[model samples]
Target: MSEIMENPKGGCVLAGINSVLSAIHRTCPVYHSGPGCCMQTTAADQGQSGHKHSCFVSGVSIPSSNMLEKEVVFGGVNKLRTTIQGAVDIIDADAYFVLTGCTAGIIGDDIVSVTNEFKTKGVPVYAIETPGFAGDSSLGYEAIWNTFIDQVIEPSEEKDDKLVNIFGIVPYHDPFWSGTLEEIDRILSKLGLKVNTFFTKKQGIETIKNSSKAALNIIINPWLFKGPAKKFENKFNVPSIRFPGLFIGATDTSEFVREVGKALNLDSELVEKVIREEEEYVYNYLAQAIGVVSWKRFAVVADANNAVAFTRYLANDYSFTPVLVIISEPIYRQEDKERIIKRIENLEYANPPKILFLSDQYEINEAIRNEEKEITLLVGSSNDREVALEKDIQFINGAFPVNERLIFNRTYAGYKGSLTFTEDIYDNL
Candidate 1:
């Protein structure tokens, strides 16, 4: 028997796909699903993420076929085509993506064929054939990237050595994705590199279309975009470097910078100078705020990427004891879990926190409650807030499903972002 997950973080696959497509500037997603699929998917991801919604098209503003019982019984292909045409005519987007809901997928609707009809007319329409039930939001992220690799990116002889495309950071789903991408872009720009964080900086389909010209692809997650990265390299001839986790605090961020520099064979003098300046900038702020926030044994409940980053940052940089670290996402691969565990375990100052792979809210809460190690501060999503309250521990809203605060370009990553994160810790205390 399949067990029910209570308050599972993020939405279905369709929700993930919608989140990614909606994040791209001037890119619209046309849903060919049931009546409420659009709204439910929007609520599942965007609604729970720091109260930030897409300004261009999202939530109720998105175009949908709204497949009904009649359409499901017969076929939604005609309706889907009409929806795509309507979105193209009215949405003013650089590209239109047709996403299949469970209903459409179950009924075996030919969404790809319908989308191809528009494509033949030179319309920027693509079909993502993955259904909502295929997997969770993480799969949605990969599916969209795979679609881009297969359909959008073109081969180019001209390549920019200083150009790089970023992957693994899911838009809206990650809550602080925009700010994190912006921080990464700012840091890379200091090294005289052009960064393509497609979800930010008004980058749309054109950027994706020309992404093959990038010299390298940087994936910042422990285990994501594996298939797409290989496909991207094979098709575009652009190699990629994978950073194990999101870089937070000075040490990891500097390490990330140096790694990128080495990969690109950038000027060593320039790279060192940038790193030195950035470290100084972070330390200068940290020096003043010394002892402003007392360190305590903390626990983090977040996705694999954030779990690793937060665990390492708190343990190694801030010199806090991590008592428990729960990866709140369902990681299927044992290798991926091992990689994440290794990163979390190999901290500098503190003992490795007890790591658990958990997704259900009940199980997550129970694990935290039953932890033998004393946790004074909890850094987690809003879902974990009540547990923190029950434990009477200080809580920092750092992860996804962040409904407590409105986050706009506020991040806890990189040199500058680490300072902001410190301020948040202090403020909460």
Candidate 2:
């Protein structure tokens, strides 16, 4: 199968093309750090929003890289003013986001105060303390969403329509995401309601501020978007439903659609039509690509929810017995924990995959050495891909490189994504 080989850890946090396009399209209450951080500017020259900071955002400009050592040492309150003011003067952003990098975090600079200072100017500014050392881009996404909800969004007394907010999508150019959004849009449309896919693709600031108007929220990945989902529920009384990545031809979509449908009291006929059509399209596609194999042995190493969903689906649908399952990122949310545990308990064989809670390369190597079964599928990062290659094993890099254009970036999200997934791994088969 198609496997990722190498990846650089830091750059612009949101690197996916689709993810960036989503952010630009929405013109949402979002900003990127300088090209230094994960928010690299790559918008085509179409309009002001598509220019630099406001380049893709029409009338918004993210802060510049003018905050120097003196300002960093004395605390960047004044320097922040210069940057924010300059951006404000140039871009007509609804609000400003003061994001932190590794240096800002190490210095313990008061981003909150800097944000308050900007707010004193009667401009809406929020502080997002996403240090590079702290976590990945997913964490940064959560920080951005949370800061927006907690600091900028005003609690409205009037209840609006029954729309649902779909938060936490970072529209990186993973081809799978396009199809995933299309499938989700179709399902939501069948419910006679529209969704606000903020900051992922075609999402913007107005869409984010109007989150209070949404009746419910659907979080695709809590790891990346937990900040916004929690804020919407706590402040607006909107319940949130979380899910792992939505892979193509996933039999589990039916249950997901059913749960959301129940909440909306949507037309069952339409829901059934969408679900049936999507599922069949995927099932038929997979049937042709995936054939019976002598070794059903598989292994999954991914983020918590992704690992749980993939391993369970592989077992439930493809009859691939996962003998080794490694959840690289530990389960943080209770719901995710429960979901993983439920799948583990339901495993047909009591001798489930050798489970390991891994944090880095050392842990993964140690786990591999202790494996009792010959691994047929290694699903995780390019690091694991290397390890598998060393052992002359077949592998698929589930998540590694943040950039897709660099490496024929393929994803496993949604039904159409599954077909691409099968194609990527076909050479190995």
Candidate 3:
């Protein structure tokens, strides 16, 4: 927190719109901020959503108020109203959301009022307040749900036992979010369960509208969607189960599927049958990979969710040694911090103290420096690229600020995800 370093992972709160835009299907983000603010500040971090620069929603091409000095002094409400109305006319959006940035937040613009004014125009308009000054990207990520809870959500009373809703895989922030979501969908599909991940290519406005109709909700992490999940449960009378992370590797994923099965009152025999089929393919793939992956040692420098799941998978399944596990997000909640720590300590060669929480890039690099030779692989963000390069280690990006690869529906969770992880690491090797 004290020392600064270059190109650290993550971004400000306003960048949360990137995830919102990416996951909300055909939804558009109408910025209540100044011109080019969304693109200039957050596009690179937005990385690549399949819908990039589209009129619907991407890191670029957001319909912004473009408030100039004239509007700033006189209040930008008129401009925001005009922009919202213009976006409704222009963009082919299933739903529209209004988000504010630093300028609008500081000037105290009534974005909510403007968005609500268009309510009866045969479209849904949601509003979220995201000032860069409010907090970091993680908080911004959680704020998406809060905005949903506070602003404009029409509760769905319809129930569909065959459908489920997934949360906590933040788009853009988690590079493989769309892919991971797709993989999860695939797994659930085999169980006769349809999932709505909101932002992935397959889902759209219908997913958002019918989210409350699902019999159950699955939040991938406890940290990000706690508020939204709870509010949703109360509002829609739907129950939820909180998974540790993206069901990375067999052990966790098997439990994830079974848990879903139990929640849905699915037949145990069918659930076990699905797990057996998935594991058979996974182990068969690993059979030929044993020689290559057997002795590899790795260091994980990722957010809390990836940090815990990646460490568990490497040590338990691949027999890879995890020399260091650095979680880049500061622990704000005791329960979340405790859960992550427990997950790490429960690893095969678990060292609780080695599971550190540090966001400063300088500190992360410094910690990585000491174990340079021992750690043969770096599973982290672009920030750790310099460390991996200097140490001559095999590196793979599994977190934010990734520029090396374009990730879309490429997952690292469940059986298929494990295979993709193997393929990527092997390719890197």
Query: In terms of lDDT, which candidate is strongest?
Result: 1
- RMSD (CA, Å), candidate 2 to true, equals 6.4
Per-residue lDDT, model 3, residue 208, is: 64
lDDT of each: 0.92, 0.57, 0.77
lDDT of 2 by residue, 55-162 (tens): 344222334444456756676556656666676677565655655655666777666776677688787766666654555445545655666677656677665556
Model 1: per-residue lDDT, tens digit, 233-275?
A: 9999999999999989998999999999999999999999999
Give the per-residue lDDT of model 3 (tens digit) for 1-429.
354545556666777655666556677877777787677545645653332333355555778888889877999999888888888898888778887878888889888777768885656887787776677667777787777656545587679998898887777777777678888888889998877877765577666666778899898874677877888888888898988766688888998999899889998998999999999988988887677754777889988778877888887877787788888876688898878877777876534337778888888889999864488888988778998899898998877767767664577877888888878888888
Candidate 3 TM-score, C-alpha based: 0.92
What are the clash counts of all predictions, listed in order?
0, 39, 5
Clash pairs detected, candidate 1: none
Model 2 residue runs over 4 Å out of place are 1-69, 90-94, 102-124, 129-136, 157-162, 168-179, 222-230, 244-248, 287-295, 330-338, 344-351, 402-411
Instruction: Tell me the lDDT of candidate 1.
Output: 0.92
Q: Name the candidate, 2 or 3, with the larger lDDT value.
A: 3
What TM-score, computed on C-alpha atoms, does each candidate reach? 0.98, 0.77, 0.92
What is the overall TM-score of model 2 with all chains considered together?
0.77
